[model samples]
Target: MRSVFLALLVAFFATGVAAHVARSNSLRDEKLTFNPTNVHVKRLAHTPRTLTNAQRLARGLNPARPQLRSSRRLAGRGGPSLTPTTTSTSTDTPTGTDTTTSTDTPTSTDTATSTDTPTTTSTDTTTSTDTATSTSPTPTPTCTAHTGVLELTGGSYNGYVSSETNSFGEYSVTTDASEALQVQYQECDGAVSYGPINFKTLNGLSTYPYLGGIVGFSSSSDNLASNSPNYVYLGGTQESAAGAPPQRGANSFSAASGTAKDYESAIWSVDPTTGAFTAHWVNTDGTSSAPTIMVVQDAIVLTDDTFRFIQTYGDAVIVSLTFAESSSAAVPPQATSSA
Candidate 1:
């Protein structure tokens, strides 16, 4: 009987060791390799696997069998809970498809950059264009052209053709016969009547500068002096031969001769021999007054065929006096040339 009891004890010990090993293997499977107490193993070994609790008690064993503790419980009591520390080597294929949806940030940036560049370029272009336009220049105007050229012969007188107050010597006009014509001013103390009026140029008269058109034997050459040919004063007094009273306030008349003399009267007439002529003037004065009349020393017979004289009064040259003639009018002086 004692041998029997020893054998039984040894078997029980063997069963406990087996159970402990089994539990250890199970724990290992669960990744919970925590060691448990012998008492825990004994309890697992005595746990009935096939029979009910009543049957086991009738079999003369403890009414309640020892229960095997779960590996999770054992781990909780002995050490850190070994849940499948399954580092689920989820092949950390970090499926983090680093889907870095890098939105087209550079595209927007490039568009803005391009826009800014064009603005700068446009500004520079506009500035350059404006500079060019501002630096340009304007044009100037020219003078008008002339009508005709003329020559002086015998008889014909010359008329005034400028608004400027020009006179003999400084600027002068003569008859066709080279006789110096004068715009005479007579200080008359009597009532005098004038002769019939005459129109010289095809276009009658000019109202400005002088109210009446010039009355004399004027050559067509003098009419081309300026645009409006009307301002002239024939410095000579009325004579009896011109159907005018020779002297209204004086008894006799003396014509002007010496230097700086003012001829008082003159007469203009058409002769059968001479086309237009100026009769000799009479009654002269040499005094210079506040508003002095034009005085003459001598007449200027043009020597050059083409003569150009600039008539000026105050500021600007009013008329361009140009004289051109035919060769027939330029007769050379002979030994018997008339004076």
Candidate 2:
């Protein structure tokens, strides 16, 4: 038994030596394993007097809440309810083949997203703070095929072409002699008086941030069905109302049907040249106190995608606005040159 014990000890030491040799040889090829991040506690900033530590702690959770990722763009709609404003659109082709809708969602490929919500979460032992910040996103690169690059010589405005039946993923750029031509990489479903609207590809759009359809219903005030492409300002009062004077280039006839309670002043306006809505306005049932909600939609850049411009104005406000492009008539593509 003693001799057997000595032999076992020798075998164990010999095995350990072999294992050491193997480990030394594997040192160069061995992979490093990183452990999970350790729990970290942090101080949350506030107005100092606003939310006390007790209040913050009251909202605290012992174990972190299970996070359900945010809803994706192509997520299916839930059971139907009284959501009259709910619009659904399908994932469109890159060639702009599908007729877009208010409900249709542009695939994530058309729009890249980043989280910007500011939040502070606390637990029994730890606290965390998150903030939302504005940032310009990187521009999407376009295939350098010279399909619809159009340009003109001496014009103050830009232009648009409406012939392409399959323009979903396709983007085009056009310009007058002056400005760099703007391009539309993708089209989502929204009734737009699209006049060379700017889709700033670089730094995500921050300054001139708000983009809208040239002629679509307001997100909130839709029961009134305030459609665009009308003289958004010329309503509730006569062309020669008490406070309202005659507007220039205003529609010659009323757009509404039946015994007109009021002249059908255009609910929206478009650029005649490029045919896009430059401004969005609301008629206040003839109440003459407020001037108008002259929302500046976009500016007139040579690089813009202008189809037509609508001329609209009112007595109190001149409404010197920019325009988008629209064209029901046959439009020929313009010539564009790359630098």
Candidate 3:
């Protein structure tokens, strides 16, 4: 019985050992099948694959053992090689168009020096004869009682205070007739400044023609000498004329500005018979003085009763005469009457 049991145990041990050995051999076969070195391919020859005909022609070299380009060619530093085996030939010739270049130099010189400084001198010079002046005494007009008279009220800016008449039978005047014919200047606040008076004669009758002209003074042969109308100019201003209150009675001569002084008056007349013209400039200050500086002109008569009477203040034409007989006359009369 002991020998039988020992034999059975030995058989079991041998079978177990054989099973373990078979599992070990299977694991070793799997490890060998998955070896990483199996994928490595070792080169046997030095040459690469055969080159195509186009590749060989493009490289200009034999297909067998073709030479590689140098590093300079790879870096685009070398020009194309002109080998004998190359079928294509090329040559480069530089070309350019004609060019022109030009330069200009300018030379100029401009110099200015202040030889004399500009001056703001008054145009109203003492030697200026624009206004009538007296070198001798002037004879004053004799005072006479008249009927036909025109009184032109002249004050500051308030209002006119005078009478209007076409004949000497209307009123009477002595030496203050010039004051009664006073007129406020067009400027100076529209007569806000007290202006001087004026004296005028129309036909043979007494007439006060201030801003406008008179009519019926025309006669035959009035325009025989010339077509331009006869004109009379009176220039000057009263210093109290501007910015002065209305003071109507003060006539005679007063303080004035510009070239026009006190009693500076002029008269221009045209003969109705001969068509002749004359001017008389007087300093109405009752002086028997010869007009040394008379800026007068001899003009021909224009239309019948049509004339230009110019009154200047400073350098401006403040008033002009007009005739109602002519259409071309400027600033025609406000009213007209017969002589």
Candidate 4:
């Protein structure tokens, strides 16, 4: 009996051991077949739930108060409460999810410019010139060519005579035949009468028994007006008829012998109207001589066979005489001669 009890206990132990080994093997097989990639872990925010004082009063509960405990107090009995307290702990972790966003916008800028310019210029010029020119005058001549003829009238020799007659009716004569002797001059211009002169009525000749013949006659002017003074020059041969009574001699020719052809020569300046006369020259001897008279410019020239006399008139009167041989007596032909 006792053996039988012991065998049974051993069998019970062996069964218990088999059941334990099977449960352990099943757990190990489940752990080995599980997929870690298919397992999903959910995360939630860690927020603890709390109640306000009003909520606590509405639920007929007192408000929570802070507890002050001493360091020696037990943690299980820290404070007293008017109501049952409950505590909840969350099992959650924070997740990394980005919430910032990005965007694009626009900006502004400006530009402008300006420019200007100007210019000017000028010029000028000039010139000039000049020129010139010239001129002159002429001259006159003298008239000397004159010709005429003279005739004696109302005299003892009433005929044509050889005499030099000037252009203005004046003539030189060597003799006068009557006291009333007159001269007539004729030319292409006209004819004129010179004198009805009386030699017996002349001064210094009134006492002569016979008045002498005229030797020469001249005047200061060729043509004179009727009222002008006649500066007349007369040359004379003072004579008495061949055997007349001797007259009282008052000049160098006073000692004349009473003979038929004996004569003395004298020169007189006379006034034709009054018969007044002044004797300028007298022959000292009884010689048959006479002077040829001429008017040259303002002078009276008288030429005789041996002498020449020059008497100038106007402004100042000068008288001069010179001895000259007669050209008619010269043996040689003269280179120059005057008639």
TM-score between model 2 and native: 0.16
Better of 1 and 4 by lDDT: 4
Please give the lDDT score at residue 288 for candidate 2.
Answer: 23
| Candidate 1 local lDDT, 90-154, one digit each (tens) | 12123232111112312211111113232432111111122334555643212111111222232
lDDT string for model 2 (62-88, tens) is 223445686666668788665345454
Worst 10 residues of 4 by lDDT: 323-332
Q: lDDT, candidate 2, residue 315?
A: 18
lDDT of 3 by residue, 75-133 (tens): 55778756433132333334322222222222222222222236322222122224676
Give all candidates' CA lDDT scores. 0.24, 0.26, 0.25, 0.28
Q: Name the lDDT of candidate 1.
A: 0.24
Q: What C-alpha lDDT, on a 0 to 100 scale, does residue 192 get in candidate 4?
A: 17
**Model 2 lDDT, full chain set:** 0.26
Return the lDDT, model 1, position 233.
31
**What would the TM-scores of all predictions be?**
0.17, 0.16, 0.15, 0.16
The window of 10 residues in a row where model 2 has the poorest summed lDDT is 162-171
The true-structure Cα RMSD of candidate 3 reads 64.1
